[model samples]
Target chain A: METEKLFEITAYTENQVGLLSAIAGIFTRRSLNIEKLLVYPSQIAGIHKFKIITRAAEAQIQTVVLQIEKKVDVIKSYYEVDNERSCREIDDVRQFLQERETESNNI
Target chain B: MEQKITGAEAFWRSLLEEQVKVVFGYPGGQIMPVYDHYWNYQAQIRHVLVRHEQGAIHAAQGYARASGIPGMVLVTSGPGATNVVTGVADAMIDSTPVVVVAGQVPCQLLGKDAFQEIDLIGMATPITKWSYQIRRAEDVAWAVSRAFYIARTGRPGPVVLDFTKDAQAGLVDYAPKPCHFIRSYVPDPQVSESQLDEAARMIDEARKPFVVYGQGILLSGAEKELAAFLEKGAIPAGSTLLGLGALDSGNPHLKGMLGMHGNLAPNVMTQHCDLLVAVGMRFDDRVTGKLDTYARQARIIHIDIDPSEIGKLVPVDLGIVGDARKVLAGLTERIAPRTTREWQMEPILCDAVEKHKVIEPEIQPGTGEINPGEVVACVAEAVKGEALIVTDVGQNQMLAARYSRFVRPHSFISSGGLGTMGFGLPAAIGAKIAAPERTVVVFLGDGGLQMTFQEMGTIMQEGTDVKIVLLNNNWLGNVRMWQQLFFQERYSCTRMLNPEFTGIAQAYGIPSLHVETREELPSAIRQMFAQEGPFLLDVHVREESMVFPMIPPGSSVDEIMLNNEDWFNYGD
Candidate 1:
């Protein structure tokens, strides 16, 4: 089995409560677990956006978007994949490399 | 032919006919036309000019929550409208009925990179129950009506109506059709009898039954129905934070609030009950600490007006989607009331009372420093079921929740879902303005008070006779408490320096009372209620006090660490 990584997806909606519930309902019915979710107004264009972190496959992501669009208030849905090359990953790598350097210096 | 009137005039007239008494707003360039119209209808509708647009929206929220009526807010285009987004979102989360009207740039200038031409509809989409952009002047009445309907109807929340400059200025052959608009959007409040019977049967048959009430009690004007149901059934009722005023605090059937910082009795009973009847509340994580363990002992029945809310979190054994008051009324009519295992339930109530008595902090009569709990209890006792209480975020809110005694729906107002600071003062002002007959009080910490302390001007200007009870702990009490417990007393930026709140209130032309000792509280409260205009009672409390039985974030309800527990005995 492949290791699943949690990715935060920002789905834009026309700020309505039922929209978030409907989108979550889609994932819920499919047995997709949402790890963490936060919905707030976006900085741009004032559309309501959700930051939902869930563990699912790429195919599942596409399906989530399609289902989300079916909700009356949702305008668009997109994901921010948690990649190793991301800034968070870079911080981790830096810490690991620094630890190695410290060990070598001690030796 | 009908007399020609601008859309702004039609909007104002429609609002007046709807019995809208007050509107909170700050004027700006694009929205000047509406303000111009506001000048004409000054007799019917009073417009309060807030220092900040955000404050105006929050005031509307305060008013809405207090009055049980939809609050109206008006803001200009661009930054003016954008600033109110937080207030609208706050109202949405807390389920306060608010109608936000924003002035947009001219229709022709839209998408033309014109100044103050931001998409108000697009911006307000997520933070509103419903949002609409009015392009034509003729649509003004319909849009305003729709906004009010969406705001005050089932699952009440904030609704936004963005009027283009052209729409506001354009003339229309307008006849104010208030009755027609209301008739078109009025929600049917009937529930299926079979479903109601099934729900009642489940409640009747259960060995241990628990009832959970939320903001829907106030929104549906169902306090009478809820109280009657609890009284007749003998079933214990618990409330979400937003549901504080649904049942009287001293009611024998009441089980206190259920959540992260909820009483031990309610939390324990939630898990122990056999049948859990959740009305008008989505089982948010705050209410149900850990999903799997929440109501583990119960078979749940969820009832809400919004179909989406039913079974959104914990799976329900029976889901009834309808208005809470109507569903409950139907259920009450169909089902004969029966006693459960009275012996088993009596012990639970006794234990809860015993625990409450034990946990209540004792105060010495002449102590120079005030006890936060005692002050809250004092205010709660002073208000005595008459005042509308609003609380700011942090320890003040929790303390108010724990200690305050509320007897009716819409009496306790706070930003529950968003937990926004600087919310209490403005909200209290709005509440007081909305319900001038009733006393309005706000419980605010030193830190939270300063965040929107500028609203002192709103109270002064409006001459709102609101009593602000400031719990002066001189610190960000909740964060400091958390730091002491979790981070080994690494108090960072949590410590707040000083402010003479009494002096500040005096500057705003409001009378001030300073209570340093517990003995002074009774007299201070008396003085506060006696005064004419707005008053501030600054109670100087002990800084090191912490709210106990706190279930830390991401922790299970059963894993709560009581104050009696040793530091090492942290985990369940």
Candidate 2:
């Protein structure tokens, strides 16, 4: 049996309703729990990005990412082992978003 | 100036633009607007009113499988939408192309839990090729076209469109939105020349090559290509259940069906071959019993249109992601032609053993209660392998697959991947309606027949010339067989006190006959085909009858049970 580890999955998709649940359902069907999930508009116009953190075997994560990309709205999806550097990068992105929100409020 | 029309009118117009002439549907409160407009388009589109919502979707699946077009379905919200979910899942797994439009509660009532409101898109997402909610009239044309396009292209599957009541009643300037492409979707991947060359080299080098295929060949319209590929390599091929009609049953290169209840030769040859070429069929557990032992001696090559399916199950040495037609044609051109090989005689030996041990006793039993396989053979003889054959799940399905002969593509339709029990009757209705010129015969067990027998009402109303053959055994024969073998005869809930089916057929205004003795079998089948709009022939098969040459679940393909006391030992 393969060892389970925390993996971060990134998916780019069209801005369509119910797609978040559609992608998440793949994980749920496999009985994998999501530790964190973030859905937001991406830098590319009309595209949405989803960052999900889950613990699963690498083989299961490969299929889950493939199934997520199989959805009609999903443009692409990738998964990789989550590490301290990647975790810091996620926090930095969150902090950058908060700073942008504060600046917009000041305006 | 754009033509302003209601969303319901747009729905009909969009169907017209897609050249869809028939739709199977049921109506309720939320979908009343669409039904109201359906009246105006009656002259252009023929809508078959099914007995239930499940019947509607299964019929659409049948129509799609028969006509090689996306079957269209319309249903109301809540129960109506939920009812079709089983058939939708069936079509998804079987790769049948069907488009379903279900009415939802108005947009405002979506999340508020209003009357007849449910999250249909959420429910359908996992099972459909694509699922979208049309909340506005403007999105109807686009969504409908997109749904049909997605449902019918590449590896075909079911698609769902949730039409809110407001969308049905809303007005929009309607224009045909023809969808041929989606930016995120690549329906057909290009064939890789390097992979084809590698596959050809492997096929050429292998001493014993075997091919196991599935419904992908028919879905790709590559029956001729498959035949050519097999002929060029002089390879024997076995078909998955859904792949039955893709190759003519009499084709010399065609071995037989492959699965738990499939033929002896293919299962045995699977263990003996050195190279395995799989086309279009997934490595379903039923086909590959105990995957660890499945073709372990063979270097497998999997060719499929879907990228996810290539390495999903049995890892392949060469995985070609492309249309079956293109890949087969490419490989055929590259591979060398062979005349004969030592492996060619393997099936002949297996066939001899099977004919004496299994086939003769089941299909040509001289004395005793009528056997289910006998009925299938009689029907095959009556139709001369010309009729469209449909089957429900379990023993009847296996018997039909074993005995029925097909000379053309798309002549056999069954619930393959999902094994939906009630699929046969409604699917027969759809097949007959889709191809009125051909005879449509459905073989279902007593258990499966009752699951969707209400579709007889639909058949009676539409005058669909479908022949219904019920293999009545008074038990869920397949499960009963398993119980006897694996579960120590603990029948559990396998027994059924079946109703007098002929009486039910009579009530539905359908001609009926019941065959109990072996003598009545041939004539009863003849009477069914003699002169009929629709006829039901129920044969009471042996209560303890079992489908033999069986690969008991979890056993390797070669570990076959030939009879109650005998197991097949190769070269015995």
Candidate 3:
């Protein structure tokens, strides 16, 4: 039997309006939950990059990446394992912000 | 090198460049500039004035579906754009390509809650494949080019463009550039040979294999290819509602339709087949009742243009992403002709049960209370499979999908996914305009006719001859059937308080007739077709009749109720 896995998909495209929501709509229609998402301007001028983390079967995510690439606004989109992931630690960042809050209260 | 022009002129010129012969539109406040220009270019592009903007979109869908070309729509801001949301969503779900351009307030008044202003781009994004807000008249050509390209490419769907009023009024040099490609927007992906091999092997080895398809077949124009593939392999086929005409319905290898309210053999075969080959059709809930139980024993293979639909519903052993016709050609190329006698009883029993139990009793020719099925039968007989049958949602739509004899592709047009109620009236007009040589028939339920009956005026003015078959059951028959079976017969608002429909048709200057008995039903249908112009036939039918072999909600395929006895004998 097939089991679910975490997938990270990275997309590059010329920055245009409604590109993010259009990509998100692909995931939303399939009922796949995005674990994390990050989008920013690429190193190349006028080019933007997107990184999405979703938990689903590999085939499902592959289909998602394929759909994302079908958008004319999207330059290229593919899935990978590590570089595709958003490396920010969830609890560590939260704890660091909490410590900052405590120190500010003491001051 | 280029002449300057107004936004409205650029819009019309760009459409002319795109070879858009007709556009369904309604003029409004924010859309005045475009209409003002429309007055000048009525010769080049025919602007069909629909009573409501919603009708314009549906009409555009019919035109697109019939012509296999992108349909076009023009509506004003706010309510005009929003009114078409349903039809846009319908196009999106059904993969009908349509380009909708709505007027906006202006750039200066952006987000100020101006009159006749709404963020149409935002509202249309989820429903359309793509959308753009044209703030500058200079960008009009670029946006129109991209909108048409995107709307008609890959999996075809609706694309909306909202232009600011100032843009429509502004003057600029318009140079229409044909959209070639977006860096990543690949309309046709190469079919994976390995997946094709895998599917071919499975089809060859499986004792009992089933072929199921949907609208994508018609969209791809793969009817001939699908027929060759099925014939070469001697495979039995079933169709979703949209896939009806993709294969000759009378083909002996055709098992029948498969879904809720589908015929007997195909629905049951879904559970029993060893291998399930889905071509161009999604495994929608209606097609696969209780997915947990659907095709459990079968190894599944999906061939479709859209990758996202591959494993969205059912687990796939092999998923191929390509156009249906191309992929089917590739797969058939890999396998030699093979035949299997596995489960021969399945299709034979299905045919026997359908003919003996369903078709025989329903259409045995009687003159008592005029049955809806008989009306469909008579209309089908009158048209002789030559006309395009467009229908509004509810029982009438299902009956048209199920009973109508559609021998040609694009002959059956209806709101399949969104199931819009008043879709037939204006859509029939568009279909007539698209193919003026062919007859166009509009079937509307009592509940549906009341929704957009005003479009009769548009029909009279345009002089597009369409025969309107109104099956007046005096109730919302589909939902009422549901209430009868599942809701303990507690009829709520199912009953429709209808006006004198013939009077309403006469008011629109269309020849109208009323039929109450089976004796005159066929002649009335023939007379409607014989009329030189638009005609309306208000057919009074059995009040409680519903499409049979329905898979009750939350039930499995084998649990389909064949008829009233199946429902009554086996109570909820």
Candidate 4:
């Protein structure tokens, strides 16, 4: 059995109605209880941030993060061991979108 | 200056901006405002009034699959909204593009359980790509545009817009908000060049490689790309049930359908292949039985547009997240061409074994009551694999997928992920409506037909020219087969005392034919096609009929059951 650990998942998203419940529903479906939850504005204008702490297997967290990022309003999502300060994925997503814009412009 | 218009008019304007030509819908109290505006927009858009809300959504799904455009649905709140929940889930799992706008009570009345109001957003959130409630008329255009944008892009699925009565009645400065981009959403993911190189290297190194694909190919319009990729590599390919029409059945590299009750060649080769390349298909349990033992020896590469689907089920050595067309084109450019036909010829042996043991007996018994496979085979012959075939769940779906040959893309539509029983009748109607030039044929079991048989009225009213072929075995044949094989043949409630279906068809003004014997089968199918409008050919097949070359539940793909007494020996 894979050992369960407490992970912190952060998601940057568009401020859309019912997004809170929509994101909460994912954790509900997996029966993973959110230990702590925080929602506030991010440094990037118009983007909101959600910091959630939950206990789950590494595999579950990997899929959960991916599923969170799958939401239409979610810009970028990542997970890390509690208090590890891992690299942010939002910058990478921004870079990816910027490159796509450049490519489309060239076309 | 933009004219101030009611939200109702704004809704119609939004659809017009999207270039939507048709919608499948039924209206009631809360949504009456939107329906009222329909009178003015009637010149621009056509509305299909289905018998039920469930029929509306399934029809919409069929339209999307058939036309390669996002299908639209509009229904009232409460029961109307609740009715579409099944199809919303079906569309989600199938990756179909549909936008559903359901009416809601006035903004103030929400949460008070007002008359004809339900928590549609709450109920639809989990099932839909995006579910939002439009409480203000000003938000109508924005919400509708975003709904279409999200529903049609990036692994497309259903979207729900809960329209409140107050919002519909309020005034808005309606200018079309055509949402071309959303900062939060990326419809197309960029492919990694290094990943493509690794995939090419693996394909070049492997002597025996197998390709399993699903509806993603058709959804991505990657049929030509897939064919070119397979041809360049000399790789044999098999399609999932929904992936049937993606590759032309006549394509030389195309082996057959894969999964339980799929062909012998693909299922056996799944085990023997050294490298497995899966594209646009999630590793559904139905396709990969006993996952631990499935393709254990193969170095697997899974390519899909949905990032979450990459490693959700079957872990892969390389997972490419991009459109199938883009990825396949990239791989085709990178990979070396192979001219050898030795490994590709492997299916010949399995096909021979399947034909002698399974195919001949099931499709051409020569001396029995009409077998279901025979009916499918007869239709395949009559249509010459030129019809858009839709099927209800159970034995009908499997047999149609197995026997029906396809020469075109998007010619096969069935409820693959959700397995909705009453999907066929309405879906065929939608397909026929979307593509009136094409011949649309639907295969339905006796059990599934009655679930939404009232849609025959819709067919009658719309004058839909669908060929309805009822495989009337008078039993829940799929469940019965399971009972016969695994449950000591208890027979339970699987048996049904079915009503005279021809009489029902006659009542709906559809020309009908009942064929109980083998001699009448061919002419009945010919008559079905030869007629102008709708025709129902109810075939009374053998009650004890079974689909053979089966992989009993919880078994490996190669461990196939040829018949009641014999298991397929791979060596033979």
Candidate 5:
């Protein structure tokens, strides 16, 4: 199985304890393992941000974004799929190598 | 014959008649009439004059969470009303029942840019269960009654009622009507027979089945039902952090906590289980580790109170959206008790337990310098099953969660959702107030203790028998720990200027104990517990201590940095 690259999403929130637990609970009930999460006060006055990383399919990523929007304190949440370029390039190389090998074998 | 009364007087009288013992608030110009009416009911009801309007709301929250009754708070126009927003949001997240009454500017001046005028109803709309602005004196009784009704029913949350100056001052013959506004808020507890059957079949067929419980169990008051279900089915269960006390930790079927920093058994079982039954908990990233790998082998059955939680994350084979107590009771009635003895699943569970046990940290026995871990471990060992422990935010909170052995439900109360730093002190006050007979211990770091340190006066004034264990690290340990791990040890603002906590405690007229060593902890704790009134234990602890097995931000659970040298040696 190919190892999928994980992406981290960070959302700013008001400083509250249950906020992280609520966010984590959302992921737990959905059976999503948060790879890593860090929450602290933001540079902006009085706001706190939680940076969470997890691995999921592209479809599931969209679902997570929507689910996060429903959280009470979340002001904004954004995520970038890390290592997408490397992953796509690796897949392309593998496919190219396989096709070349198949042609040689036929010859 | 009933005498004629103004709307404000009638509202206060109705509240007093309902046996509302106290109201938390601060007074202001727009609310002068209401406060005047409030004086007449002073004999029947008490008013706590809080320094900050926000504090009043939080105090009410403490009372409600402790007493399991709807808490009441009254704040005056504009800034006074806006100050209570934090408390409202806090109550909403924790499912605390609170009724916040905010004084609005006069009706005629509402949109005329009057001083201290605000659209509080609009500001509080998203955070409250329901919100209303009383336009007329006749509407006062209905609004107050409805606010209480909506706050206490269903999932239970905060409600706001903005009373116009006119409504508070307007005179009309008023009689309080019975609350009928919450008729639609009632929740259905029973799961359909088909849903029950499907969940049962999934449980019976799976080889490695695991159960995950959340705060919904407590919200639904389904502890007894859940315990019975787990015992009968012999299903190994784990709880989300919020679900800490749902099942007794000593119960053979219980698998401790699940998620980031969760027990190894639950984390591994989650991945290997053929079937997973998640009750009342929304899937959170901390619990699941990595979505792609989480419960890959399991067909999920999600039972929750909120309908939106279903299929929000992991796809569920069966979704039962109702109250946890009702659904579990229904499942128990329909499903036959099954023994996993035939499958001999005990060894699998035992092996998981045996593999995950951390060897006791090698420190010189009875060393005077307090190791933060040992102090936490000792507290866990001492309290074991009795005290309801609340921790402030930062490393202290994480350490407490890690070391504390929670054997009963509601035993561990931390700001899991918000991770609010000052939460521990006030929450402990609330928990103790809720269950006075039960000892409440609050653990706080030096930094966290300072945030809501003012509440120390509240404790002294109430003569509450709550114990505060201060972990004096001399710095914001969590940020410093992260700095050490990720920021190359350049500690910035994490260093905290010292305070004489013992003197602060003494100034509050509370007994104080100071401990600088692990040997001193038990005796200090004993001394504090033996005291007649509230006590604070200021324990000096190592500032450099870090929580191990930390999954660095954006990393998977398997990529944990185990600080325990033995666990690393054992190749875990």
Candidate 6:
């Protein structure tokens, strides 16, 4: 039996103009409403990493990833279950900075 | 100083390198640089001055459809670019390869909303396989080469390259390098051995099997191999509208066409077949009448080059993502021959053909006047299945599709998915330009012909031999037929008041003949074909004729209206 779960798809793509919208269009066509999207320069100089989060069944996410990887600019793409992720958000750093500032004030 | 060339010079140089011989275009303020330099290269490459931008694109589509090569279209910016959106969408849906070049304002004034400037890349993105705007002159050669490669390779469609005025005029060091690879784009996905094994097993096991194919066979050039496979397997075949000419119309293995207004056998027998081997076609709603009841009993073996199309509309038991020709060749090796005879499958199909007999009188000549089907029949008899047939959408298109016999590949070209009414005339011009050796006949309605009638000037200027059989039904027969059948007979604006087409053709320096009665059609068609140059034969057809075997809207494939009684009974 297939059940829905959160899946994270990470892709490394050439930083070209309009490529973002092209990737977004893939998600839109699949009826996969993206819960989160993050774009930043990858380890390579000219390549960018796009990480998208959506809730879908396993078979559906695999199909979506194959479609994303088919784009000319996309270097590679893969989907992972929620537990497979190890990451941080800028919002978490902001909270840590606020906590340190309060500690300094208390001192 | 190192060698340097202008952007326009590089652009033209790249086309020469790509071996593009003909380009359909119209000039305006923004595209003057290319036009100015065009004279220098006129002897090497020919540029067709189309009357409108839409004609350029549709001609490109027709050229692509006829020749299996990427057609080229060059248009000015703004409205000129927008006018081609319809043809671009049509090419995208039908998978015809075309490269569209549009000139834009100078780079500095791109987003300032300058005169004749629009966001062409943004507008063309959804319609084309790829869209890009080159800001630098150095990018011209690479971009043009990539545009051609992308448009012509793997499931071909239209691609757009937007050129700014500065890019078209600027000079830079010129070096031409052919683009053979993109880092991430894979045109052919590797087919799996396991999938083929499973498919071979399914075909060998299933006793009642049916084959339905589409344009992919032509795209991959698998027609001969596919014919052999069908003959060996003893599987009956059906075709999509675009797949009409993939095999000989009279091939014994061919059952009939499959769609909304397709032949009765394939549509009726699809659900009952145990194994459905669909090649090259995506399961469009038009092909699959009602999704819930369409081939539900069958285990579908879908073979196509496009991976995404697999299991998109209908589920697949064994999906092989590869070129149709390659996959069919592979399947032929693995699957054993079936000894079952051809007559085993004939009884049901013969029954379907017998029921389809009602279509004979509707198209045949009657006492009232010349039937539209008779006009197509006359042309079919005259051409004898050798000419390339292009049809405009609606009544005329349906009649031509139903009545005509197509024996050659890529012989039937029209706007199937987009249903653009103005496609036939300009596309016929493209077909003639691409395949000058073949006889190109266009079947157009009075309504559709008027939409792109200006193309008569292009045909006259080019001096191409294209026979136009204008099926002038005074009413917009398809729309009126629908309103009469489904919409309580209120035909609001479907009635057309047409001008004298013969007179219109005369003004464009093309000869024409008119035939309104049944007796005149046969001779008029011969006259139209006998002319060495372009000629138009205006055929006046009965206003009340309706195409039969039509599957009513929101109805299953089995529920086809064969006659007036079927239409009336469904209303109750």
| Per-residue error (Å), model 6, residue B32 | 1.0
For all predictions in the order shown, the interface RMSD in Å is 20.9, 9.4, 14.3, 2.4, 19.9, 14.1
- The whole-model lDDT of each prediction reads 0.78, 0.91, 0.84, 0.92, 0.73, 0.85
Error of 1 at B295 (Å): 1.4
Local lDDT at B12 for model 1: 92
Q: Model 5 reaches what TM-score against the true structure?
A: 0.79
Off by over 4 Å in 2: A82-107
Question: First chain of model 5: TM-score?
Answer: 0.68
- Relative to the real complex, the DockQ score for model 1 comes to 0.02
Give each prediction's DockQ, rounded to 2 decimals: 0.02, 0.27, 0.24, 0.59, 0.03, 0.16
Candidate with best lDDT? 4
lDDT of 3 by residue, B1-572 (tens): 77789998899889988899999999899889999998888888888999998889989999998898899999999999999999999999999999999999989998899998888887787788889999889989988988998888889999999988999999998887787555446677778888788888888887788899999999898998898888888788889988887777687678878888788888878888899999999887888888888889899998888877878778888989999989988877876696655576877766677776677666664546877877888888887788888988888987787788877888888888877888888789888999899899888899888888888989989998998998889999999999998899999989988889899888878899999878887788878887899999999999998787788877777677778775312212
Better of 1 and 5 by DockQ: 5
Indicate the worst ten consecutive residues by lDDT in candidate 6 chain B: B563-572
- Candidate 4's TM-score reads 0.97
Ranking by DockQ: 4, 2, 3, 6, 5, 1
**Alpha carbon deviation, residue B314, candidate 2 (Å):** 0.7
Judging by lDDT, tell me the better candidate of 1 and 5: 1
Q: How many Å off is the CA of B36 in candidate 4?
A: 0.8
Task: Report how far off residue B19 is in candidate 3 (Å).
Answer: 0.4
Top DockQ prediction, candidate number:
4
Compared with the true structure, what per-residue lDDT tens digits does model 5 show for residues B1-572?
Answer: 66677778977976865568878778998888889988778888877676567667766776776566888888898999998888788887777789998888888897788999987876776577667788788888777887776677666789888888888888778877656422113334346778888888777777777789988887778989999888778778888877887787777787667766666556656665788999988887767767766676679999987555787768788998788998888777766677763433543553444344431431223454576656677776677667787788887877677667766676877666656677777667666766778878888899988888888887787787888888898989988988998998899999989879999999999899888867667888778778877899898987686666555665544455555332322122
Docking outcome class, model 5: incorrect
lDDT tens digits, residues B1-572, model 2? 97689999999999999999899999999999999999999999999999999999999999999999999999999999999999999999999999999999998877999988999988998899899999999999999999999999988999999999999999999999998877677678779999999999999999999999999999999999999988888999999999999999999999999989899999999999999999999999999999889999999999999888877778789999999999999999999999877797889999999999999999888887878888899899889889999999999999999999999999999998899999999999999889999999999999999999889889989989999999999999899988999999999999999889999999988999988898878888888899669999988999998998899889899999989999999988
Best first by TM-score, ranked: 4, 2, 6, 3, 1, 5
lDDT of 3: 0.84
Judged by whole-model lDDT over C-alpha atoms, candidate 5 comes out at 0.73
Which model, 2 or 6, shows the larger lDDT? 2
Cα distance off (Å), candidate 1, residue B504: 1.5
Where is model 6 more than 4 Å wrong at Cα? A1-7, A27-33, A43-45, A55-67, A78-83, A86-107, B341-343, B346-356, B567-572
